[model samples]
Target chain A: MRENLLDVENLTIKYKVKNGNLFFNRYREFKAIDQVSFNIGPSETLGLVGESGCGKSSLARAIVKLVGLDSGKVTWLGKDWTSSHASTDRKFRENLQLVFQDPLASLNPRMTVSEIISEPLENYRKDLSVLEKIELVKKSMETVGLSTSMINRYPHEFSGGQCQRIGIARAIILKPKLIICDEPVSALDVSIQAQVINLLKDLQKRFSIALLFISHDLSVVKHISDRVMVLYLGRIMEIANVNDLFSNPSHPYSQALLSAIPIPDPIREKERKRDNLVGDAPSPIFPPSGCVFRTRCKKSTNICSIKEPREKIVKLGHRVACHHVSDEESK
Target chain B: MNRLLEIKDLSVVFDTPDGSVKAVNNISLDVDRGECLAIVGESGSGKSQTFLTAMGLLADNGRSAGIINLNGSDLLNMQRNDLNKLRGNRIAMIFQDPMTALTPHMKVGEQIREVLDHHQGLGKKAACEIIREMFNKVNIPEPDRRMEMYPHELSGGLRQRVMIAMALICKPDVIIADEPTTALDVTVQAQIMDLLNEIKTEIGAAIILITHDLGVVAGIADRVAVMYAGSIVESGEVFDIFYNTKHPYTLGLLNCSLSLEKKIDFLEAIDGHPPNPNNLPNGCPFNPRCKNVRDICREEKPEIKIKKQNHSSACHFELGVK
Candidate 1:
């Protein structure tokens, strides 16, 4: 068995919102992410899937300490780093990097490719000389398929795909053990997305870096992930191996997500029943009681709306949070 | 079948400081009544540009020399006033971002009423009643309550629904939705597509869905046109295009789409970025990226070659995917 490189337990996040009229104004807690827990092993890729406004970004920010967590334990390499300050968690920060959604916005326009890539190296290592830094930057650029000579050009000179390469270079310059990629390839064209995904896989295999790949796209996530986690209203819905999850999704939410994905072939589409999730996703501010997905679940019952379902071991290693599935299995 | 829109040799170019950037070059396609024709390509493939130019809606710096015949009228050379009369009345367009296209200050009901007021000469009371009915048709729940809400008050999906209702208020013969579902979530996208299909059939109007998503194209398009470098490189009946893809670029696009049905060792992506419009190559635009690129491909540009009764391709080497 592989060592558990990261551990998260009972992670709950909330924001304060004002409620009621002027005279009866009261502060109410808005739960963006409910009690969610998952772990990533060494060099493994954990794919987080959900629709928009589902707290995936919040979870990502919480891990990087960019935002404060309400209640949870986020341990990296057997060390509790959730409550740790940036200065105290310098080593952990170096080992855990984040690549954002938009590479154009993430990178500074004034900064050249070399400078953007070398910023991390300079921050982590102060003793490196100019010549050494240049060499490191050149090698890192080459790793992401950019020419060393092109490093002098500014970010605006490159295309969307090339800019993303620069972002990947910056994230990996420190050789982080874990990289939190939040929709890194979603901004690029399909062909360019393939190039970036392949580059990521090659880098991960060579460096054995664990990846927390978050995206709303199931196809792209299924391509590179070792295990996949489904999230809804800031809670974990299902976690299973990539192949198993795609083939036999246990959660109703997972099934709805899988069915909604438009397949390229019309023949296969005709054979498959349209798995439609009724109603828009419930507001995260006032999520429904019991199961968050019950509001949209086709198989919802009286018990589903009344009682919150806990994650139950469904398969050999897979776990799902749904009372419908558990009840069917028991019967 | 009535040809609602027929575009012939549609070439559009934008004048820039560097040079003329060819946005849409000699592309010919037609949309029939009650048919949903999807123009699919990556960004800058000129699918949207071609249709936009056909509608006589080019930017200030852009010019077009082509035949944009709409319902037996030459829309391209029509006077601005004449085109304006036809634009929102006989033909309507829904952009990708409804928030930007819609006014934030106006109520959702008033937006629909404004469209009617501009073209149909409807009074406030009549337009409001029509707006509420259109809202119900678009499947917007609590139609009356939502009528008073601003654009900001509605969700992205609902805002798009409002845009659709407003666009279809006049029951235009053609509806051009440019990436309508691009910003929306998958579930919402599905809902939108279903709604669009239902409305197109109900109104008997041709729908032109401009998008880069091949998956969406596969789902909704009766016919698919694959564009590259400001040209329609391949187009055919949906089944032929999906099962017997005839162009290198089209095949590459099919291979690039990630599938969950079978495990793939690697995604087959077309290498290299698309050629910049300003620095276009001499021959076929896809020659640089085409795997089967021959010596002839680099020397002469190939015209569209009709392979089947309904399928055509613009590649030097014919796709052997029988």
Candidate 2:
């Protein structure tokens, strides 16, 4: 069997909101991640594409066990990490690492670059000497295209892109198999963004690391991701190869998104008709009962409102969650 | 075509302790009446700075040189008070972040009314009536109830609509939108663009769209100016800039743009950072990152060569690309 780097099945994360008269009433549960399942193979890049509050970050945190999962199984190399095994799972921490969205917020301002990179190494490998930790920190910094002499500098001294490189160096110090990079380049300037993207691609090649690159930018995802999963309101709308997803987007939401891209050419732009989704995205506190996309979906019908559309394989590997597309194409 | 706003050799400089930073170098462009001119560039490429400087909206430390003519009247030559009077009344600017732009302490109705009170001869009652109509034009639901709410009470999309409402309340002749929808998500961004397009057509005002996203500029802009390091490296009809791009920087930018088209495994990134404004390179600002860099591009700065009737490019290899 080909070794799957990581497998997250039916993962759900719900935060408890404490309100109503101090300690009197029961706390309400806010479901951030609503039953999502996906996997990353060895040396493969699986993109998790979603908007601001679609629970992409929450799913990343659940995989790292930084946040508690309401229910689901996260398996790494056939080892189950759920309930009893989650806390005791030592391999999970060593194999999985996460880089947060904001570089400035993720990094500790007080700590120097050397200390930030070496922190993980110190925690994971207690047997290693202090000199060895220093060597490893220097090596990882070089891997992310940072200089060793600059290691003594604080996080505040570096630019946004430089700070992200430092963050990547810190994550890779442990040599984790899977890295969940959550909007790593979103906060960066456009020109600096390209630099960081190229660096990530290079590191991914050198380390043979599986990346769960989460982003709202479709362009960035299309460039880095092997396969793309489009999410809307904590539900997967379409899952296909990057080429197929971009070229032949079957789902209406994906089509709308793809059409929304402003072509630099005015004539071509005028020719292309974009069906802008109506109204603001509904609150996730109490999402639509049927298909989550029905509220804004142009093709949503009675069947969609009554029952959630089943995930069907449209192409060899492409999966879509749409009744209209599935039914029309199937015939 | 009659020109609505013509900017000639515009240069905006901010005097700092470090030195004079040329935010917007000697650049010139014209926006015809009812035409949408998109100034496309990345952050610090001087897209917003050009319009801000021309409008006399820059802070005290900032200073601008050259002519900014609105129907032959030198806007730059006008008095500071006159400039302020002409600002919201004639040439209105809408910023990127609407949440921060709107007053959190004041009611939405009162805020929009203040624009009318200063620009137009209208009292609070008359202004309130006009404000509700503007809100309806922007397609804000519950316009009556919304006027009572503060900035914090509305959603991001709603806040942006309110900003649009305020900018269009006086029915300005020119609308300068600086990345109006950049902060919002993709879906909401599309809606905002549609709304802006609708407003432009209904109001029949010239628009200056300043943004980094090429996709957003595609449908709206009539002409496009590709800026790099505070200068217009390429300017032409939007169709020519996108399809028949002359400049290598413009081509690289289009290639880098994420679109509906399935890109190859690797993206074509323009190699280096945009040249620093304060410490700009001697020759071409895009020389370091440009792939088609020649000996001439490295040694001497290239002048803007008029390729077609309206198309212009400042590159050694302008005609080399198809």
Worst 10 residues of 2 chain B by lDDT: B258-267
For candidate 2 chain A, which ten residues in a row score worst on lDDT? A83-92
Which candidate number would show the highest lDDT if scored against the true structure?
Answer: 1
The TM-score leader among the candidates is 1
Clashing pairs in 2: A262-B215, A262-B216
> Chain A of candidate 2: what's the TM-score?
0.94
Q: Which 10 consecutive residues of model 1 chain B have the lowest summed lDDT?
A: B313-322
CAPRI-style class, candidate 2: medium
Clashes of each: 0, 2
* lDDT tens digits by residue: candidate 1, A173-203: 8898999999999899888898899899999
